[model samples]
Target: MFLRFGFVVGQAGIIGTMAIVLFSNAITLLTTLSLSAIATNTKVEGGGAYFLISRSLGAEFGGAIGLVFFAAQALSVAMYVIGFTEALVGYLPDGTSPTLVASLTNIAVFGCVAIGAAWTMKLQFLILAAVLFALFSFYAGAWTQFDAGIFLQNTGSGFSGGESFWTVFALFFPAVTGIMAGANMSGDLRNPARSIPLGTLAAVFVTGLIYISEAILIGGCRDRETLITNNLVLSDIAVMPALIAAGVFAATISSALGSMMGAPRILQSLARDRLFRWLQPLGIGSGANSEPRRAIFVTFLISQAGILLADLNTIAPLITMAFLVTYGLLNLATFYESITKNPSYRPRFKFCHWTTSLAGAIGCGIVMLLIDWQWAFVAISLFAALHWYLSKIDLSADFGNVTSGLLFERTRKNLLKLEGELYHPKNWRPFVLALSGTGFSRPHLVVFGHWLTSRTGILTLGQVIQGELDDRHRRRISQERMLHAMIGEHGLNAFPAVVVASDYVTGVEALVQCQGLGRLRPNAVLLGCPLSVDRMKIFGGLLRNLRGLSRSAVVLRRTDEPADDWKPPSGTVDVWWRGRANGELMVLLAHLLLQNEDWRGRELRLLRVVDNEAGIDEVRNHLNGLLKAARIPGVTKVVVSKDPELAIQTTSRNAAMVFLGMQPPNIGDEEAFFYRTEKLAGGLSRVVFVQSAGGMRLES
Candidate 1:
């Protein structure tokens, strides 16, 4: 592709343009160094690039890249087998067909791999020897015809084939990618940590030197027109043309055999982690050495179909993008580890630096876009989608994913910065500790917690398992697991936490006082109102404790029945404005809920109940001023009624939720206040009495 686009120097001028070999190898050299750095730091086992990335960046990213890497390797198998077939057909008698040769070659390669990785690896040595001999013969023959004066010939194609330098780079870039052929055998090696870096880098250096030599040979030995017209210039100039053919066959077959062994191992690793549960069958091995024979058979089927159906040019760009993306991610993973300066990042192979990893990442990205922006975007999008899917699966693996460590480091730094800063009401976000039993029993309560903390803050669902102190300790682990499963089943972002206590009151007291590390301590508490008055007394006591702790509280009670379909509440949110702290907190929460996409178009009505018509205008103006200053988009109203409970019920009957202010339940003999609160929410959907301890004012 590069030669057609005028990117390459003509054969006679290749000596001048030999830097292309350096340029290509430079990309791999960066990857090799970065790979070596990470491999040495971590205990890398199988999955090759996938294992390294997942261990650093986490499964979602690792799984996504693994999918792409597997495809690239599998397609490489087809590409190589077809390459061998092309060489064989080139040297065959007139009656031989290319398709038949390709089919037979694919079968042979697949059969060798099916025997297992042990035999395939053994065969590689013999193939490598043939490859070396062929290279020797070609160089010897080329040197006999070589002339230094040929370097001065015109090498530009002048867009003869409507291709550019980037297109050429894309085509030839895959040639330098054979470095991974050794790295992919990491699973088979007993000491991948020691061997991968040494073996991979050595191959890269040797291959690079060979490529540069070939460029010089082609430039100095062959004519420009002849090189331009015939890509088989190596065969033409070789001392024995047949040796060139034999080398091509050996090289392509070796690559095919390598991929056949490597790709399945990736699939096996992915399945072992249950990243995609449906793919678990691929992880089952049939050999005593745990050869991925099942995975191998699957790989063979995929390659066979590609060999028969795919065109080489069509598959080339895809393979290029996949490898480029993998290389970029690998570098990014190492760069993250280095920059974070995590104490765990010490590598046995210490030659790597953060700057090099970053450069490698940037180089991979730039080349991906430069080669073909369209394909680059497509490949990136596909990986992003895969990551999203894997994240949803919540594949359980302890890869020591780097994101957690990065978060920890950043959080520590931010906490240190925050220590010197003064606390402000404007920065207050609801870090809520919501008490609940089961989501199935209290669906509305869970949904309410989600809405309150949707995008702005953290909401942890705290479940207190009441039992004898001794037995509670024994059952805590099992109970926590069940609680976590419930949280997962409900698909809530809210964390599930369980604590055991001797009694309900003690449990509530402990949960209310509990605090997470650093700034993660809960600033608010939420709970569903109990049906019985006795149960209400228990919640009332919890509220009193929370008030003393200076934590905001929300007690919710559903007065209106849920829809028969039982979907989450969605509609208008009504907030009753009293004044100062309580009103501001209630309105702020309602507005925060509006910020979510689900509640975007929903109404937020700020309502005030006045005793008579005389105070109606004043209240409306005050409420309007508050709304304007707070910048909360909502309607304002004043209801002049003798019975405020009737007014509230009528105004917010169809609303999704109603927020009402109550005098601190623990402060006064608020039986009348409590009675009126229940009466007001009698006909409303879901009513929450919000009490703000302090720090509730808007920025004004």
Candidate 2:
């Protein structure tokens, strides 16, 4: 406020001060132009530096910068309070005691700052407008005192007196620092690009002119120790101490208000997008839809904490120095894009291919060269460390909850239409087939696999209703439903066979249980897999049982798909008349196979497995003897397999169709079983076992 304090720098130092003023102006121009360019392309949603940087760079950079912006804004608010109180202290009349007024004013400004930190944009605009007018009056008031020749007198030489060139440079840095205060609010602007550039640049120009004007005006007042007296303006209508203090305080408050208006929204954006998880928990709203307010509060709170521990007086130069590097990075980002000719490099506001930005950085470094390096080092190092951490920690790892897996998957997905050969049918329409229901699931699976060897089916769901229930009745119904559903679903109405579950693990045992006067016997006895260890014993029992039960051969299949996509397998009937059972069943199976396609002679594998040397000799002899009478080609095999299942496995190795006798599961059991002789789930196989009594059966 005093012309005396302006004389703290000798006349010669004012010349250096003028240069400092010019440097600050340059910084403002650069800050404004850069921020404006970014603002136009992006909607200037609040979150200040955080919003602008994140959109231009990415979420990580934005998040880290948001913290810095918030910190700076909060600190400025406190600095405003202190400045206002000091001005009030200076404003008290000489005769009146100033302590009470100074103390009360300090408390008042403190409250005002707290409220301002949490204030709305409309209210802030008012404060800014009022304070701006007050600040303008200072410039107008001082304008009349300005003299061009005073500048010439002060220009003794560069770094005259005890000041070094770098010392003068350091003084200018803080003056430029205020430009960033405006830049931080670009995110809140309606048109960031245009407004950021214009507001920032204009502020710097106006502020720098005012600072220079004040220095010039004060310097010209006198060579006296104090430039202006306390009552000078009141006495002769000249400079007034009260007016000066009030004006500066108002300007400071306005600048602080701008900080509150702008910075936190950047942090809020970071929180929303998760520039970092560490930052996401901040910006909690006090009211409904108070995102901006919440962000501002958090920002102010942190900045206040920082300022309290080491207020602006202590940290101002360090902040300016840290921000110098910040500006340089921006310039470098712009430079890299411009030089690489990357499409994003094109700028709306141009200044010699990014030199304007570089100049800001170099100028910042020059000022820092003379300031407190310890503080400057700490600030710059902390910022650099933060940037490094942000880069190294993947946002996905650290802030993954902010977005969805779908987005990450899509972003990282390779350009492929299909993952693999999902399915193929030679461009044919998808085939439809069917399978029956199951008491449990094993039987239907085997049956479906058998059908799928030559056809495709759709998934079918079946449910059965029984009016009455009891343990015995329930078992009966379950079995009945299984059989009926299987028979109905696979369209086996024309066939006499039905899929059935068996009490015994043996295939022939199942056959026995399924056989009765009205009960149906399946043409195919499908075995999922050998359910018992002694499959050979089961097969032998099946052979012994087949003689009387009058069931038929079995088809065993394997598949991985669900019971859907199944249909009756394709095969040709090759019948061997081993007995009356074989003769009748061959006639029946031949009829069924022929219904689909002509039966080829090669498909007739009348296989019979003989257990021992004597049985084999007898079987070969029978084949020769029976063939002599029939004049038909019949396959006869004699294999030694102590294991009953092995015998079937060996026989199935060469024969697609194995004709053998069918056996009942047990005496009095309506459905009987046939031992499966093949595991050809992907192909077609039929095993027919003729019973001694009624007829034969063929399975695929």
Candidate 3:
């Protein structure tokens, strides 16, 4: 009915302007199709656009876009109020002041919205009837004037002055954006699962058909000059101009009231999502009806700010950008849901396709850029900033975002592809089997194992509970609970399992034997230092068994008390290399530990002891070669002393942790190996004794 709005800005002929409308409707149709598909698939709730987006794309994206959608809805209230005021001025006597009429009209509209939603909705139905009558009158009056020759006036001249097709297209786009009217009211609908798809698609089809028919009637009934000259062509063509004016007034006021009501609802939803701490007060509903009084008041203030502006010419582009970006992201979200191939993504609506969603997304983006490149950039930047902030906050909405499913699908495919690929040295990772009973008594063992794995490999905490087969189930459950508590409390990303065995030795054997699966078996095992002679025998036996199973082992003992160091910890890793296979494994483990953020930038020192000062340089040179071959950065220090224990203690006093190679402790002896290592670490920091078997060799 108001197709002439395009002709005032651009000199485009009737058909040229209608082309813009058709394009906009095509996007709206696509969006409607996608929205229907999603609404049918899931249980759509109050958040409307935000609910759909957050549940599909994740909270970060949903929160970010939801903020923009709220602002757009609020600003749209001002836009419609201003339009209503303009229409009011058009009907008044020629002497009437336009500014005074607009100011009073704005106040009346705000008051109507503030009174209550039920009253406004009742008024909405009355206005809708007036709009329908006006639409019918215009079509009826213009039917007699519709001549075949009128269609021949196809010259693409826009306005009497001149304007680009893109400029004209921007103005027409908002007409099609009405498809979201039904979606914004999704919260209040009783049967959103059934109502949203049916209602939204119906609106799109009806509105789309009306706009297309109106475009044709304008082109077929009027000449180019008449279309350009008459800005109020709907009134000029209507049987009764007053009825058309009534339609214009009702349409504008109803639109303004609708946005005024819907904007606050979105704000309340956002506040409930904890999008910002300050928005908490807005989430509180005041009446038995759960009215968003606080949110409504805030929206009123924002609308007043817009109303106070002299013109909406500048704000117009921003509003369009907001809608375009929202539409684009909505399409993108649907596309991800379809492409993820998740079994849960079964949409009840059969017309949905990834191709349709993709096209809609790409179309929105292209149109947004074409309309205004700088504004498009600004819109995207705002979206990105909001997304980054929400991600950092780590807000928990638990909306079953599609990111995890997408990543899982990709990971599965990549792993399958990699199965046939050749192995390489640089790709090697340490799969560690860290044995710590409950992992609580010795927390550092698990922490160090996590560091050694560098988050790129698997680290499993294996606890062996000594119990009889009769009480095995209960004991295993208890041990598993304890293990889980330790893992959670420490914030360690490691899996845990418990085995019930008759004795400690049997438990350790079971743990070592069943550590991992086919290609993911644990290549390294970590253990705590033995405290007694009986434990020493168990440790030696376990070490022998691990060696037979082709695994590397590290026996650790902390000498000094632990410190609460900062992350990417500030300390040194001293590897006391003894020129053996175990020493090689120790150096490699130290290198891997450095890969973790907790150990990043910490010092890595490789120390060796020699009998004389003359051979110290030779030892340093040899260690340097090993460091180069290992492709790890380190400082090689050669100590010229007869006593290596004194050398280790004095040199590693300030180090965070020290690593040294050792032979398995003898059960029959004084357990001197453990005692000697304890004495060596007496005045130093934490220490770990490395013992490597065949499976621990460098990957290359």
**Predicted structure with the largest lDDT when compared to the true one:** 1
Clash pairs, candidate 3, are 10-158, 10-159, 11-157, 11-158, 11-159, 12-157, 12-158, 12-159
> Of models 1 and 2, which has the larger lDDT?
1
Candidate 1 C-alpha error for residue 212, in Å: 1.3
- The regions of model 3 sitting more than 4 angstroms off are 1-18, 93-100, 155-160, 409-700
* Candidate 2 weakest lDDT stretch, 10 residues: 424-433
Query: Residue 428 CA error for candidate 2 (Å)?
Result: 39
Candidate 2 on 264-308: residue-level lDDT in tens? 655666677765676677645444435455565564665455544
Alpha-carbon runs more than 4 Å astray in model 1: 1-7, 93-97, 154-160, 409-700
RMSD, candidate 1, Å: 22.2
Superposed Cα deviation of residue 250, candidate 3 (Å): 1.4
**Candidate 3 local lDDT, 1-700, one digit each (tens):** 4634525223556566667766877887787778887776666766677777877787789999989988888888788777777777756789897666666766777788777777878989999999999888888977877787866664455454545777777756777776676677677777886787888878777876777677667666777676767777777777887788888788888888888788888888888878678888898876666777788888887877787874567666777888888888888888988876433455667787999999999999998888889999998999999999987884756446666545432465554534433332323457788886754556667777877764456688888777786778887887788888877887777878788888877887787777764345677788888767666766777777777777788877764554652243347999998876788778877877776776777889999988898898789998887765454678999888888889888888888778988766554554666577677777775788888874333322
| Cα misplacement distance, residue 411 of candidate 1 (Å) | 6.4
Give the C-alpha lDDT of model 2.
Answer: 0.47
Q: Estimate TM-scores for all models.
A: 0.59, 0.49, 0.59
Minimum summed lDDT over a 10-residue window in model 3 is located at 418-427
